[model samples]
Target: MDWQEISGNWVLIPPRPSAIVHFLGGAFVATAPQLTYRWLLEELAGQGYAVVATPFVNTLDHVAIARDVLNKFENALDRLYATKTLRKAYFPIYGIGHSMGCKLHLLIGSLFDVERAGNILISFNNYAARDAIPIVEQISPVFNVEFTPSPQETNRLVQEHYQIRRNLLVKFADDNIDQSILLAKLLQPRFPGMVAIQTMAGNHQTPLGQDVSWPVGQVFTPLDAIGQWVKQQVYRELNQLKREILRWLNPLS
Candidate 1:
């Protein structure tokens, strides 16, 4: 997957205070299908954020495949930062992901030295599918990164921080709801303050595409509604990110 700027019907927000916000999309869908995501990117740009959404092939399932894709993303970020096409310096960098995209973010965030990254935002992270052993095994060789339990590692390595935010957002009405909760609990000990899971109504794939309006007492939720909700969340997060960038640029004020 080549890292490219998001194009087509999307608005661009100039970088504020030298910060860049990149949105990563999930599996089995092209980046274009994520209309709500597009809106979010535009909103972020409107708020003085230089937003870029990178497209990747969603064919791979294994953590190793995902990591390879993430490497491309990391390299693209480096190129973008080096060109300094968006803004000045001392700006914050952030990665935003949804669904499988969230998993990819976790893998990259944990393995890569994204310390310069201001923060990571993840939505609907279903950790049940990810094989921890394979993920750790694949990632360990890349960085010579062994799992040595330390204070900082304990905090940021797992999705602990994410859990705090999750308790507020979660609305469990489905069977797989436990998957999200369990993943957060499992990661708490290792990455005490890393993962943040925000809950929205619907199953794993509900928020990906368009939202639908179902009749009352219907068996399933409307896809259109879920899609709209996802889009709304994306817009809100991007807008906040833009504000953060603007603040970073004018720190003294």
Candidate 2:
């Protein structure tokens, strides 16, 4: 299905969607999530989900970014309901985020009054400006630039204010910058048994499925066989990721 823009967010809704997923991508690629996360979001839409991927420019004020995206997502939902694109019947909403996006979702859940069935936080990263951005690192000492909430302040807020109970913290095996473990530690205490963590095999960029399709010829050559094998391996990890997400999203199923 083709993606449609609703209230400044990229949306893909199938007929009679079972759930709504509010998605946020990583720091840089968030500006074009429709292109960057096309494969994963389209897969979710195919699985009977109304995917609303909100694109935001990375800023130091994560709190403000969270509020802005939340507002846009709500507006898009309202339009979908009003236009009869989605049924009037209740559909559970879930927040899914990657890298820096995870921190924004956490802030929204902590500071706003939004309801979510649960949140699937993948590769949650809350790093200081110096560490996260190289240019910022070079100029920070001279210009004094830093995130508004700061990494420490963000943690404090999550520890003291985050309200959502059910959470699935996904950590990647080879992601050096991932901080899902720390997030899980903070959230587990607040909600106890409600917080669960899953470690996957791929790295941080696993969600960004670069699905390159190569055509096969009638006279299959060695290069064709190698290309096909590579394509299968690339999609295998993505398919596994999708299955795990679906399992967590619908545990009873």
Candidate 3:
């Protein structure tokens, strides 16, 4: 669990990893990826995957974001190879994204010649900036930022060009913001039986992180037991989600 800077990007690498994982978090989350996706990345690290969590303030121009994603991932690999940090510079690279991150991966797949094994799209949402970002609808008239791919354009692009062969779309049962079903519909025409859609009992933020501490000020409350039960359910769902993700990514295994 060490952090290093590569080509001006902060990355966390685990010791002696077998493969690589490129992670992208949801929209407007500019916090360090290492912190925002701490639980997911740490678990992946423990599973022997070198995870490179790229931090970026998600903007309207998703195509631009996708380009930057490629740059960071390629640059990281190049640096590792140049320094002889890993025996092999390139390994099976998997794309892992939550929410808006899924759109970027889909864009990457549409573009030709990216070395990606597969992708896991969790709680996918491709809402317009005005809709996705609260109060942006009110403020956009004053300061407009016409985000590229505009949700409609994202579909147009995917319909015109999508080269991904394997995809795993996971949607949580309680996630009302999820568009995984819609995404699966779009990808099914292109990838056919290649897309695997899995439904689990959790919400959009289930895999991100958890707070397990019980409320200490109160001796006990009726909701306290319910809260504990819900927390346990979250942990269980997350573990199952991880297992399904790994299973889909590692087909031969």
Candidate 4:
């Protein structure tokens, strides 16, 4: 697999024992100019946490592109794990994704179901809402609401799609408020303490864009204010995780 270094400043935060932190990029974008998390990485390394960022090309077409990028990331993780880097026995791995990257994270996280595989999604939205237009068009011709598929059959099909939508929303909330709520619900069942969602006030692209001021200082524009908020949140979460790891390793005080 061809791997590309996401152009931008990247810093590695060393973790005690040895843990891996994976940073996933957004859709149609390679890396953010601000290089969000540089400060966090330094802080984490100081506290004994190893951090790494894998830059992948963001091509928004088929799922193969995302899968390929994620595969490359997984390979990097394998290398790190083989090197005997972190403190945790199972290699505590956390994933941070923005926008479409968040969707990719869910797909990968769900597929792997690793022991310590935790995830943080920023600016996550209901996948259905984001792709509603296309989904509707695709299924519209299959089932005619006016005639074919009978009432029972129509109900089943509609219910199936509805469930899919529900799952998407539950996995990724459209805005910060609802997004946090959705994340809480989803994690409570499978990973009560492992999942976290911090909804910063911004649209989808905020986490990737560094600057918050643009398009007349409005939240909607080329980028959103949430971009800064997401970066700050990532740093905070990484540092917090590092502290917890330190505390775990050295409990007596």
Candidate 5:
């Protein structure tokens, strides 16, 4: 699947879409959204989902970043409508987020009136700067800088403000940083619609790339089953992830 950007938006437009998905990546780098979420985005695109992936610089000020996501979504929609690529842009809009991306989507759902159809949160976490990066703990005193929406602040905001209807929280088996439990705990009280938590067979980085080192631009031996086995193993986690997302998004279908 090939997609070009319009007005600083990377849009993966499918021929016909079951839904429109806005993809948000994790923290640390302000790199290209397609670069980090390529595997997941491609899979979702193949499954008839139009995905708009946006990049952002990770910062302590998460509230501002959340607002930026909303702005990016609007800009992408503007471009799609102007180009006439979206014949009918009335499909339900969904937000899919990983790590810090999950926090941003949750913030948007809570604070903004975006009318999101659903939200898929994977491995959500809101760590203080000191805990998020152990090294930062050592130097925090020198800069007197603190991470905005620290763990405590994140919990408080979501507990009081989150208002999304349909949500699917995913947790991996071996991920210590799987903070879905905490997020589910906070949402159970306020969320009126379906709030489901699912555990899959992978780690925090499972949905990001589907594999740790291989299957990414690897030169394989020119054999059929050998290559196919490796390919399946490489993307097992993400394959399952995509399937789960489709099931949740269109349960009746």
Candidate 6:
């Protein structure tokens, strides 16, 4: 399906959508999520979901970023409803995020009064500004800066606030930078049996990538064969992630 821009968000709406998925991508590729996360988002759309992917430029103040994206997402929903693109009847809404996007979703869920059926956090990473953006330390040694809520403060907020009952934390097998386990510990207590953790294959960058067309040469070469194999692996990983998310999204029925 072709994506449309509404309220500064890229949206892919199917003819009949069972639910809506509000997606936020990782910091580096978030600016153009429609292109960077096209494969994953479109897969969700293909599975009867109206995908609303919001793009945001990353800054040190993650709280502000979260608030802004939430506002934009809500506004887009409003427009969709007003235009009759989305039915006025009750429909489930879920939040899905990758990498830094996961932290934004967490902050939004904790700080706002928005209603979400559940949240799917993939490769969650909450790093200090110095570590997330190494150039910040190299450029200025005099000032000490960090994310607005800070890593520790974010955890405190989640522990004290996060109201969402259903949460799915997805951690990749080879992702060294992932911190979903720590997040699960913080959230599991607040929600008890509602929190679930699922381990998947692939690394931090698994959620980012689009299909590339590998042109055939006059004669089939090993390099060409290797390219085809790599493409298959990428699609395999992406499809696996999609299946896991769809399974959690429809656990009961």
Better of 1 and 4 by lDDT: 1
Model 6: lDDT to the true structure: 0.92
Let me know the TM-score candidate 6 reaches against the reference structure. Answer: 0.93
Per-residue CA lDDT of model 6 for 66-185, tens digit only, reads 999999999999999999999898889999999999999999989999899999999999988888997888754677777899999999999999978899999999999999999999
Off by over 4 Å in 6: 214-230
For residues 34-79, write the lDDT of model 5, one tens digit per residue.
7767877887898899988878888778889888878978888887
Query: TM-scores, in order shown?
Result: 0.52, 0.96, 0.86, 0.49, 0.90, 0.93
Clashing pairs in 3: none
Q: Which 10 consecutive positions of candidate 4 have the poorest summed lDDT?
A: 161-170
RMSD of each: 10.4, 1.3, 4.0, 10.9, 3.4, 2.4
Q: What is the lDDT of candidate 5?
A: 0.82
Instruction: Specify the poorest-scoring 10-residue window by lDDT in model 6.
Output: 137-146
TM-score of 1: 0.52
In order, the Cα lDDT scores of the candidates are: 0.47, 0.92, 0.80, 0.44, 0.82, 0.92
Scored by TM-score, the top model is: 2
Q: After superposition, how far is residue 236 of candidate 6 from its true place, in Å?
A: 1.7
Cα error of candidate 4 at position 242, Å: 11
Model 4, residue 205: distance off in Å is 6.2
Number of the candidate with higher lDDT, 3 or 4: 3
Which of the predicted structures, 1 or 2, would earn the higher lDDT when compared with the native? 2
